[model samples]
Target: MRERWRQGRAARRAHHRRRGLRARLTRMFALVAILAVVLTTVLTVGATFRVLAQFGPGVGADTAWDAATWQQVASGAGRSIIRSAVQAAFLSALLAIFVAGLVTRQLTRPLARLADGAERLRAGDRSVQLPIPPRQDELRDLTATFNDLTLSLARQEAWRRGLVADIAHDLRTPLAVLRSEIEAMQDGVQPLDGAALARLHGEVLLLARLVTDLRTLSLAESGALSLEPRLLDAEEALRGLAEAYSVRAVEAGVTLTVHASSPLPLHVDSDRLRQALGNILDNALRYAAPGPVKLSAWADGEGTHLSIRDDGPGFRPDDLARAFERFYRADASRTRDPQGRASSGLGLAIARALVEAQGGRLAARNHPEGGAEFTLTFPVPSGEPPSPQTRMVTRAPSSSR
Candidate 1:
């Protein structure tokens, strides 16, 4: 009963506030109209009195009455004029009140709709979209903005739902594996040997990796990730990464190479940069087997550019558009490797996040030469010049592999 009373009182207060807009507008319009009528009436009465004073017997006239007669005539005329003016003013005020009502109604209709839409939105209705007004005015602009706000809210809500579902799906697989392995050992169906324990450990590691990647992605996206940025040689970094991953490339029957036409300087977090590039390179080696993967770096007027290109089946149109969405795999075959190791599908998303957190942009496109290309661009810091050294480094696949 107390809750009901509270709600009722709140509703009453809201209604009271809502009524104020129309009341204030009506009062304002009526006040202006009444002031205009009164001013006109006053001017008309004053003009009549002035004319009477000028033309009556008191003034220089040829055939006028005596002063007392003139005074009486003026007084009677003044009374008649005053009566007509008062009657006209009364009628005008009534008309003004009626017009004020219509005007206020027209003005508050759109506002009322907007208020209702806002209330629905507050009530968890993400799809509430208000109709825009037809007239080109401030009200119409406000309505358009509100519609845009609703659209953005709907998109965010959808993304949130998708994120939760993806996380659950990714977690369920490794968890199932762990449960099954433990159950088998407990039932004496499988020996609790080194191989079995190793298998279980691998699944645990997968789970840990997924959780870590999710945390990193969240931090990067929320601008809460810590970074230690400094000036670094972009060309050298590319060469170093290429050398580090060359063995893996060769193991997969792929050739990994780095090419730099000139020295390129960049201001960035070295560790983060390596992390982003490593993710892309790993993807390239995984999918572009038996083909060539190339890393290139250069600097131009725009900024420093680092790109990884692979001579494999390029990305499909849909993949190119959503390659960075978390846990979005273009093909079901991409869900696991040939060795049966599951993919968390957050590699590209985390890479993009890390790059963007450092004020750089990452983009994916199908190379014109028939392969996939991922590029990273970073802005050059002020007062820093590119190295003048004109050198190039290239590493090729080992013939023994």
Candidate 2:
């Protein structure tokens, strides 16, 4: 155990020896400059010694100079050169240290600020704004990334708070109604009968549906949703969705129709696809004007496209942008249906999430002809070639519509 502890301590010491960016960079510049100065000084001294040796004693015997005099001259020249070189090296080292200190501080200040901002963010302060410097460098890129992270976190925090509030609001209405009805019945004010019981049952069902929708959304958001994908008839899927919602549409004084253009085959999660399409149809039936809601499916070179168009007051221009945001309703009028039943605003958001999870895209637009239309597009899966017979097939309008 002692040996193990000692090894751990040694490892930590080694980790600390690996210095941060500024210290490492400063040491690098200082070492390079010191090396240059030392090399220059050494070369200068060596050249001086060589020159002195060449002219001294034996080679100068023919000249007037004696061996002792030559030795003295050589010795004096060598000392002077050595001293001069030492002084120059010392001065160079001082300059290197000063320059390195300046450069290190310049590079490290931005990173220090970034570290502090990160800590603040972790502490739940989303208002920390990092001012990006004008310099085109890694620090600028880092600052920009940090800024985007801050903005994203702020938006997510806001959305979280809004979701909590919306959920509470939704749950409160049904619960409050149930409590009041039960209390009234207990006090002999409202008698227990078929009528009163049905009202209570309706509230219970509404609560159940809201909880179910929330669960679906949660699973889809967390990437925990299980999907079973297979190749299936796209036309059949559309017709199935239309038939499921046809009764509700008729009761709401709206006509629902499905127009299949061809033998459209698509690889998708059949049940999930149905849920998404059903949500779209339900939304149309609830909010659209009393007119026909058309569902159509067609195949093209790109892939398969399914559209649901409703003859209603189309989405407001501003609302169109955020139509898929969870718990978002365009206005108060959208809260309840004509029969005073509440609508869970998570339908479109969940539908989009489910569709995208299956490698498809869902989009909404104001149809030029009259109302709002939602289009779902899925690309042909890889390794699955389009069938040669899958040509564009448009059927004439059915006489029933």
Candidate 3:
């Protein structure tokens, strides 16, 4: 009971100490108005007495009045002026207070709403949004900024929740498989043979890959990914990538080709760029089996452009919109590669993260020739020019499937 009493007393003190901005502003305006009225009245009364001394009771007249009469006349006129000035000042002061109240109310209403909305936000309500004032003033700008902040917080919260769910769902499948396999072997329902061991090993590898991809993605998105950037010939890099993946293309019965109009210079991290390119190529090959895949590079006034086009089915509208989302696959049923290896569904996401980390952009769309195309653009640094070699290079495998 004593503790409760202490709490109640503290609450009372806090309430008393809470001086509102509206009240303070109103008081300030009232004080200023009253001061102005008093100052004006004093000046007006002084001016009236001076004028009376100059022209009243016989000054500049044929018959001049005595000093005593002049003094009496001046006193009477001064008193009358003071009385009228006081009355006018009193009425003006009242009007000033009323206007001050109205103005202060108008100003403080938005501030009060903002404070309430901020309190709600502090209590973990991300959706708290204040109504924006219609007046084109600082208050409106402030409210708009607050609304933007609220929207950003909401989006981040949603993304965090979705990430957790996706991680759990991805982990559950491989874990379940591993547990079931081990349990079956222990129960003597399945033989401890090479195939069984291989299956278990595959699940373990899938789990490891998923974890690694997640870490890389997290680091990239958080701007912590280390990059060793250098200037390199774009044509040479494309040729090297094509050569590296030629064997895979041949096995998949796909024709891989690289084309460059000239030696385009690019400044980027070589290893990271290769990884991003490899991931996109792998994705294209996965879907465009037995079809032609083209790699083209060029530099223009805008930037350096690298495009990969695959003669396969393009993305649906929904898939295109969410292509960079983690663990988002257009065809949910196909979760494994043709070789029966599990896919973590983070390839496109990782590619985008890596590209963006290097200050570049990646985009996907349907090519005019009815195929999926992915383009990567890297901005040229200021005061830098394209490579002067100007040699056009086109590399293709000697044998095409």
Task: State the lDDT of candidate 2 residue by residue for 219-287, as single tens digits.
Answer: 987889999999887778876676666556656777676777555778899999999998888788778
Candidate 1 stretches with Cα past 4 Å from truth are: 1-103, 338-342, 385-390, 399-401
lDDT of each: 0.82, 0.80, 0.83
Model 1 error, position 321 (Å): 1.5
Off by over 4 Å in 2: 1-61, 64-71, 300-302, 339-341, 383-401
Indicate the TM-score of model 3. 0.81
lDDT ranking, best first = 3, 1, 2
Over the stretch 1-401, how does candidate 3's per-residue lDDT look in tens digits? 66999999787556534533434465767777777777667767776876677666556648767889878877877776776677667777776778778877878899999999999999999998898887655567678899999999999999999989999999999999999999999999999999999999999999999999999999999999999999887888888888788877777777777877565878999999998898899888777677889898877877898888999998889988998999998888878756576788898999999999999999999888798999999998666676645444433445542
Which of candidates 2 and 3 reaches a greater lDDT?
A: 3
TM-score against truth, every candidate: 0.81, 0.81, 0.81
lDDT of 2 at 11: 73
lDDT of 1 by residue, 88-132 (tens): 677776777777777668778999999999999999998988887
Error of 3 at 392 (Å): 7.4
